[model samples]
Each structure stands twice: as structure tokens, then as C-alpha cells.
Target: MTTLTKNKVNDLIMSQIPSFGSFQTLREEGLAFLKEKGLPAMKEEEYKFTAISKKLEQSISDFSPAGKVVLNAETVKSHLFEGFDGDIIVFNNGHFDSELSSFQDQSYELNQLSESSPENLGKIAKIEKDPFVALNTAAFEDGIYIKVGRNKQVEKPIYLLFFNQANQGQIITPRILIEAEDNAEVTFLESSISLDEEAYFCNMVTEVKVAQNAHVHYNRLQHENKKAVTVNNFETDIHRDATFTSVVVSLEGDMLRNNLTLNLLDSGCEGNMYGLYLLDGKTHVDNHTNVDHTKPHAESNELYKGILADSSRAVFNGKIFVRQDAQKTNAFQQNNNILLSENATINTKPQLEIWADDVKCSHGCTTGQLDEEALFYLQARGIGKIQAKGLLLYAFAGEVLEHIANESFRKHIDALVQTRLGSSF
Candidate 1:
């Protein structure tokens, strides 16, 4: 791990200036924007519910991260899919580790960021908009660059693994870009693994470009130790006759936030979003998302659910926007939460803003505890309380897991869900 104080993060960026390559101008722009805006404040509407800035300052007086943690291939292998066949890309502390990774397929081509330039690099996820995005743009030393060939379909799903381990603390920024040419089909999964007992922070950004007649599916799994803090920003552009789907599952973390943006740019395009978070202890997870439909005959759907126990907290704020020309658009969004204990809390808001009269849009949110009547019915049948509760919670979470298209991956994720709930219930 690379140790650097938060105060000297800029120095790290400057030191790597020579290796930035085609992203040099973007780094410069990001540096300028960060200088002007600085980090987000609690008073900001977006960060009002999360006091991450304060948490950072309090955790480290100088806001600097130091320390080191190590892991070899054996440890990483243990975390991989058991008896599963797929391509794996490993990232250690936010940088690519080619020696520990393998990609054996002709359906796609890979290039280093310094040697390649994606045409729509900074357009879909503009650094000018978010401070964290700007920081990642300026500080990221290396990341993944993949281009799927036209009309080609990947036989196996690709997995991206991010590992973080620090004794004291460390800040990691990483970037990813995926370009699916016309008529291509692909599925990608992302996982964040935390090893060690120290504090660490990760700010990651991913951008996806789906050309006409192309299909892309991306799923994320975050189950890290309580000392890890995470901020993930995801953006995608859907063109005409294209499709995109993003599913995120959050099981554990100290403080985690997700900012997702989807843009349906042309007619006959579709997008789907699904998320589930189960937490206990003092853990907190927040999600903010936006979907914009700019053309007629476009559709979008979103669903987010959470189960909180103890003093854990969860937040959801989602918006669906339909432009004036986006007539005949079909949009739906919903957020639901279950608080197992009286101390648990949730704040949820789902909204729809439409400038078109002929569009069909709906949004709503709900927060409550497990159904007492259902629980009693199971107990009346001679089932134990813990078993009944597990059955009920698992049923509620199953809705989101059903959206996973890959059967093997879906079953793997289901096992994880069951194990997590089994221990808590």
C-alpha cells in the first residue's frame, strides 16, 4: 500500500503527472475544479444525510492515510467463485495487477489508459459535476480499458476484483471505462474485498457506453469489514435500440454511498436498476440515483430495498426525469425498507419530474418492520422465531436477487444472502 497524508494527496498526483498520458488534460481540469470546489460539506443537499467529511477528519487529524497490508494469489484465489469458470481482473489498492489476473477471450480487447484513449472518456461521467469524480480523475494512476468487438458476445461473465488492506488508513481512487460496440453483448461483475483490521477509503468511478443494438449488464457486490469506507459513482449512456442493467448488493461496511446515473439518449432504449442492502450494527449505507429519458418510446425501471438491524441506517433518494420530447415514456421507481429493531432508521424518497404530458411515470417509498402477522403464522406452525424471521427476510430479499440473469452467479449470491441472514437472525 502507498501511504500518503490526505493533505499531501495533491503531491502524489503531481508526482505521477509524467505517467498520466492521454488523461493529462483531464487530470489538469480535475485539479483545477477540486481547487475551486474542495471537498463536499455537510450543508450540501447531497451530503446532508452523510457526515463522511467529518468522519475522515476525526479519524485522522491531518486527513492523511498511512500503513500497509499484503495478500498473495492464494488468498485472492480463496475469494474467487468456487468451481466457476470466468475471466478475472484483479486490482490491488486501486491499481491493476496484471500478474494476478487473466483474460482469455477474443471477444474484447484491453488497453492501458496511458496507451489508449476512449472517444467518450470524460463525456458520460463529467468530472466538472462531482468533486469525488474530479479527485478520481486527477489521482487515478491506472485502470481498466475494454472494448468489445462488434456483434460479439462474451461466453463467460467478466469479474473485476478490488482489494483493500491498510493498517492505519489509505485513500484509493480508481476508474473504469467500457465500450460496447454495435450489436455486442456482455456481462460484468464487480466485487470489493477488504482484508486487515485498519481503516481505508475507496472512491471509484465507472463509465459505460452502449452503442445501438448493444446490451450490457453490470452488477456490484460490497461486503467489506466495518473499517472500510466506500463511495462509488456509476454512469452509463444508452443509445437507440440498446439495453443496460445495473444491480448492486451491499451486505457490510462502515459507511457506504452509491451515486448512479443513467441516460436514455434515443428511442427504443431501455434501462433497469435493482439494489438490496442488509446491515446490522452501526453501519450506514446511502443510495442516490437519477434516470433521464430524452426520447420517445423509452422505458426505465428501478427498485431498491433495505433491511436494517440494531442502530444501522439506510437512505434512498431517486429521481426519474422525462424530457418534453420523451412522450410515451414508461418509468417506475420504488424504495422499500424493513427495520428489524426499534433503534434502526431509514430515510427514503422517490420522485418523478416530467415535462411531457403523454408519459407514464410513478415513484414511491415505504419503510416498516417485518410483518408481525406473518411471523406469528409461521410460529403457529411450530417454526422457531429465528427460522421464521429468516424465511420472511429471505423472501423479501429474493425479489431483487431474481433479477440476476446468470444462474450460477445468482445461486452464488443467494448462498451469501442466506449465510448473512442466518447468522443475524
Candidate 2:
């Protein structure tokens, strides 16, 4: 760390003396760890492919406080789904903005962390060796906590929208916690966008807990700018007879890293994750997912696909662990990528560690260009080269998009995918 930047970071760290009252201990530990470890170097094994410490110093040169209403309803309305009706929770510069948000459903509990103290706030997403997680824990601004009652079904989908307008290069950390009680069902839609083209850094962490016989559908749309850098850490735990599904779409960004971890705590649990990233220009996107099958009769399915264009780069590392006691477990993972330009780069690793003799597990990865035979067939049928390529690319991306269950949200994502491919092709 340079003298100037180190001083800035140290000043920020010292400013967080009386952090959240109940979270003081966690914050102190996080601050101490961050001061000792600083940031991950480029030589680190996990962050070798995607380096962000230098990028953070470059993009986030200074710090500023942000709690103002930087966006109006009209500007915010343009980002919402055209015809979708749901609860809209808006956060400006990482703090909840009541004037810009509305919650119509009273069935589920949604409150700011500064107001309510929940038991599972930092349980699943415990601070680990990651510097980004520690930074978020020490200097988090505001957060949201959601809970659903037992056997109750939330009718409307909860939309968590975040807009960053800290024009002077700010580092924003947003925290979220969700709990689905036994036999409960709910859906969450999370998205982030920058109001300006200025550079900024966003560090986010979300933790979820699903009880017995419960179901949770979590979807995230990454709508970032060319100057935006993000690090997302997501952790979830599934109990007996519960199901958890997540779909992540990365459309554009300067540098984005996602660390997703899921653990099956009891038997009869199912976890599914699907991710799609469409990159162009000098964009970079990395996804690391870890699934641990600690109980028997649990199944996990993960499929991540990417289409890289121009000089863009992407990385996918998926690992599944089947413990010795986790018998009769079924786990499948696959990562497929396509490179359109000669300068495009991809590093994919699919891993499986099975200690149970009665388990069935498979993992593999594929990186190549679009199929020539298919392209030739499309062009041979009177289709233009550009149109044919777009069609093929969209079809390749459909495998992950089809996992979106909501009709309106699916169409919304489909439109975004088509527009992205059309421009690139």
C-alpha cells in the first residue's frame, strides 16, 4: 500500500470505532484482520486470475460519506421492469432510502439492520480469510434483514435495487440477510447499477437460511458500468427437505468477482445454481462457487456459461465436496465458454471431492468458439453471417436463462441478453 492510500484506508478504519452496537465485536475482529492482512496480492492462488487490489487503489482513490437522495423516482423508474408489480427496496449509496422505496406486502418482515437486530445476521456468512469480506464487515454502511413466517408464502417478489452515485470515487459495502422459516416460500430479485459513469467500488455480502420444507428463489442481475468494480460474497444454508435455487446474470462490468457458497446441513435438501456472463470490451468477470454436501440424499446441480468477445476475460472455478457421511449424494457441475475474438481469455476449473463411496458426482469444463457446423448450417439457409452468429450465441446462452422461473423476469432477462448479443455480434 502506498503512503497516501494507506493513510486514507487507515483513516476510514479508525472512523468505524462505534460500529453497530451488537456488531461491535465482529467489527473489531474484522478491522484487526484487515489491518494485519491488508489486501490479497496478485500472487494469491484464489485471486490469481482476477486481481482487484491494485484496481481498488486506482478506482477508489478517495473516500466520502453518502446518504443523500442522488436519484429521483423518474430516473429510478426507468430501471424497473415495465409491467412488473412487486415490492421495491431502494438503496442509495448503500443506505436504505424510504422515499424511493415501497413495500406493499406486509406478510414478510423487511427492516433495516440499524433498526432491528436479527439472530442470523452474521451466522452463515462468517468472516473468513477474504479481505473483501473483512472490509465489508468493518465498514459496512447500512443493511437489510428479511424474514418469512412458517408455512406462509410471499405473493410478491422482493426487488432489492441499489444505485451508486458517489461521484468522487467511493467504496460502498451493502449487507443483506434473509431467513425462510420452515415450510415458507419466497423470491428475491437483486440488481445494481451506477447513476453516473464515474469510477466506484462496491463490496457486498448476502446470507440466507432455509429451514425444513422451505423454498427460496434468489436471482441477481449485474448491470454495471465500464468503470465499476464489484465483489460479491453470497452464503446460504439448506436444512432438511428444503430447496434453494439461484440464477446470476452478469451483463457488463469493468471487474467483477462473485464468491458463492452453499452448504446442505441436513438430508433431503436440494441446491441449484445457474450463471451466465456476456462480456465485451475489456470487461472481466469471475465466479467461484463451493457446494458442500454434508448430509445424505442431497443433490446439487450447477451450470455456468460465458460468451467472451473483444479483449474480455472470464474465470469459473466450481468445487463440490461430498463428506464421508454424505451417502447417496448426487452432484453435477459443468462450465462452458465461447471466445469470439483472438484476444479473449478464459480460465475454467471444475472440481469434485467425494469421500462417500455411495455418491455419484461429475464435473467438467469446455472452452472454445461457436460451432462452425452450426454457423454454416444457419448461413446455408439464407441467414446473414451476423444474424446467424447472434442466433447461435443466444441459443448457447439460453441454457442458463431457461432456469429463470418468473415469466416477467425471464422475459426481462431475455431482452437484456438479446440486446447484449446483438451489439456484440
On TM-score, the leading prediction is 2
Query: Candidate 1 residues 1-425, lDDT tens each?
Result: 11223444455545544344787888888877766676676787888888777665555333233322465789779888755578888888887788888899889988766668877777888997677788778777767789998999998989898888754445677788999999999999888998765678888889999999899999889988897888898999999999999999999999998999999999999999999999899999999999999999999999999999999999898989999999999999999899989999888878889999998889988898889999999999999999999999999999999988667778888999999888974
C-alpha lDDT of residue 364 in model 1? 89
Candidate 2, 374: how far from true, in Å? 0.9
Query: Could you estimate the TM-score for every candidate?
Result: 0.94, 0.96
**Each candidate: what lDDT?**
0.84, 0.87
Which regions of candidate 2 fall more than 4 Å away from where they truly are?
A: 1-8, 16-20, 63-65
Tens-digit lDDT track for model 2 on 1-425?
A: 22334556657776744455777877787777667666776687788898788787777765554555557898778988866779999988888888889898877888888778788877788776477787788878668898898998998888889997666556788898899999999988888988878878888889999999999999999988888899999999999999999999998889999999989999999999999999999999999999999999999999999999999999998999999999999999999999999999999989999999998899999999999999999999999988899999999999999998676888999999998898875
Candidate 1 stretches greater than 4 Å from native: 1-19, 60-69
Question: Which residue pairs collide, candidate 1?
Answer: 5-64, 6-64
